[model samples]
Target: MQHTDKSLQRKVNFLLYYAVISTSIFLVFILSSFVGKDKNLTADEITVKRITVVGEDNLPRMVLSNETRQHSGRMEGKEFPKRERPAGIIFFTNKGDECGGIVAATTAKDGSVNHGMSFTMDNYHDDQVIQLLNDETYENGKAEVSRGLMFNEYPVGSNLNDRMAKTEELKKIADPKEREAKIGELWDKEGAKRRMFIGRNVNADAGVFLYDAKGKPKMKIYVDKAGNPKIEVRDSTGKYKNIIQQ
Candidate 1:
């Protein structure tokens, strides 16, 4: 009976030891989980060089990007100018073409300062047909600023890609002048004519200039630098036909 009591006491001591070890391990695990884990993140601003918003098809639909990484304008069957541009937002059309964008730039170098912004809408397969723009420049101790809205024509039935292809064909001409003349003719035949202008000119004068389809200025209403307001009507040849002043 004494031997049984001793063995039972030993068993009880062993159980207590086991329980202590298990509890210690659980406590250690809980502490380590709290201490070794990362804290919840909080931030006020996130900076990035470029961001592209893609459509459901995983194709880029809009891009907010910088100059160096600017997306070259996309045309399905044609190649286009791939030049560096200012920081801007470029948007793609439903057909996956580069359709429009707003871009701005500022430069202060070599004692000259200049900045500008343009908001443009492009025609299919073509360049900008409408633009709102403001540009300011200071050079040689002179400053010039102009803010304006402009409208240009897009060939009614021609795709821009086809026009680009025509330019390539012009290059096959052996004579440089002949190629240039042909190119100019092609542009005149297919390019959008600047048909309207309204806003402040470089002289800081306000004006509205209206052009005919052939791009001849047919009417002008303006305030001159001397604060004189005038309305000038012109013939299709840009010859002044009448002048009204106030």
Candidate 2:
């Protein structure tokens, strides 16, 4: 009877051990199921100051935000100071450099109302090479407007950092005359050149303006707001003389 009782006690202990082990594994599986499944939520509205979209490699590829929260663009791993960017989307290149973006803004300041929108495509490591823009500034009863497509040219292989450095160096010159001369030299040789402009100039002339390699106005093929047509070419005196209209 003693041996049988001892055997029965051993069986009871084994059953308890098995029950505990099975219960622990079941609990673990239940918890893991909750953790491993993806949950989706639907929402009607979401408010945020900024949103950054990242690549699978965890680097930011795009960003949308207000100017206050906008990321200052970077080139060559160096970021410029935060500038007055409009509310819109900014894009990044594979190298994490600011490539180009779309922006729009309206504001009233100093008794003037200004509104503008722009879409730009930048050159590699440089400023905007092409831009589509519409802009207006209104004061009292008058308005100045610029609306059109523009194309700009930069020095081949010139980057923003080097350009900015040269500009800053020029600013340190104490003599106003010497500084002005140096500035003219810098601009005449290596400045950002306006290659072409197709839009309404400040004078309310809607036309295509062409420039030479030195960015001197070469031709004007446009009509004024008053319906005056001009197909003028630059003369030796550096003036636009109407050839077709005359």
Candidate 3:
């Protein structure tokens, strides 16, 4: 009977131990589940969103809808000089949420000009759409050409001025035939590097003149409509290479 009693006690102790271990494991599982729930709840509560200003209504004049993906506008006028003809109206939208108005301008009617010159004014109130009329002047109430020339946001010399300078330089060089040969050689060897550097340092539409070996003007290199340098070779047979923008 004592042996039986001892055996029964041992079984009870073993059962108790198993129950305690199972309880502990269940409690740990419960705690982990609670933590997971809290983490999921926290994640669900937080959210982020991006707001983009889009459409033709968002851009500035001289900028085309097809040319730029987001935010663009255009305006045109014939009142300005032929070379300074307004290309179209442009609208610059305020990217910041703070109180600000859209700046607008118009290009000269004649598209022959290198750059359009016109200006307009705009006002800014909190979360409001600012509209500018094409006929209006800049905030300072002056014409675009009158204010100053800006390449991107920075000021630079005018296209007319640049052209005149290049022309003067060409005149200084004497032999036209030799100049052509030199320009051809340069284009074949170092054209890409030189053009890439110039495009970076100056306005997208800036013009550059190339002279031949004899120091005479051979061809004119200027930024094309797409803002890439368009190099014209004097000899139709001359080979030219395209520079890929990295």
Clash list (residue pairs), candidate 1: 153-192
lDDT of 3 by residue, 89-200 (tens): 2343434212222333343443322232334332221111222222322333333322222111111222322333454565556798766665555433322111111221
How accurate locally is residue 132 in candidate 1, as Cα lDDT from 0 to 100?
A: 98
RMSD to native for every prediction? 9.8, 7.4, 23.4
Of models 1 and 3, which has the larger lDDT?
1
**lDDT digits (tens) for residues 122-207 of candidate 1:** 98778888899999999998999999999998768767888888999999999999999999999998988889999998987799
lDDT of 2 by residue, 73-133 (tens): 8787788887877889999887778889999999999999999999999988888989999
lDDT of each: 0.85, 0.87, 0.39
Ordering by TM-score: 2, 1, 3
Q: Estimated TM-score per prediction?
A: 0.76, 0.78, 0.17
Lowest-sum lDDT 10-residue window in model 3: 146-155
**Ten contiguous residues minimizing lDDT sum, candidate 1:** 33-42
Best model number under TM-score = 2
Q: By summed lDDT, which 10 consecutive residues of candidate 2 come out lowest?
A: 33-42
After superposition, the stretches of candidate 2 with alpha carbons farther than 4 Å from their true spots are 1-42
Candidate 1 vs candidate 2: which has greater TM-score?
Answer: 2
Clashing pairs in 2: none
